[model samples]
Target: MDIRQRLATNLRRLRLEKGWSQEEFADQAGIHRTYVSDIERGARNPTITVVERLARPLGMSPSELLA
Candidate 1:
């Protein structure tokens, strides 16, 4: 899969592993819930800053998120 697909898969897997609902994850990530949905769906081309926001709550680096 491509980076977007990889991110979508990893993000969903990580979020589920954390037992966090999308809304809850979004809150913890300091991002919008809908945006998180879009990201999980591989529909959003998140910038580095937004990737950082997501990575922080997941206890990983942005590169990890992409990986």
Candidate 2:
């Protein structure tokens, strides 16, 4: 898969693993739920900064999210 797809897949998996909804994940990540949805759908190409923001709540690094 491409990076966007990889990111989306990993994000979804991590969120599910943590038993969090998009809103919950977004709240913890300090981002908008809509943005989280966009990322999960692979419709948003997040910057490294955004990745960092999201990764923090997931207990992972941006590179791990990319993986």
lDDT of the candidates, in the order given:
0.95, 0.95
Candidate 2 residue-wise lDDT, 1-67, digit = tens: 9999999999999999999999999999999999999999999999999999989998889999898
How well is each residue in 1-25 modelled by candidate 1, as lDDT tens digits?
Answer: 9998899999999999999999999
| Residue pairs that clash (backbone atoms under 3 angstroms), model 1 | none
Distance from true location, Cα of 42 in model 2, Å: 0.4
TM-score of model number 2: 0.97
**What is the number of backbone collisions in each predicted candidate, taken in the order shown?**
0, 0
Q: RMSD to native for every prediction? A: 0.6, 0.5
Name the weakest run of 10 consecutive residues (lDDT summed) in model 1: 1-10
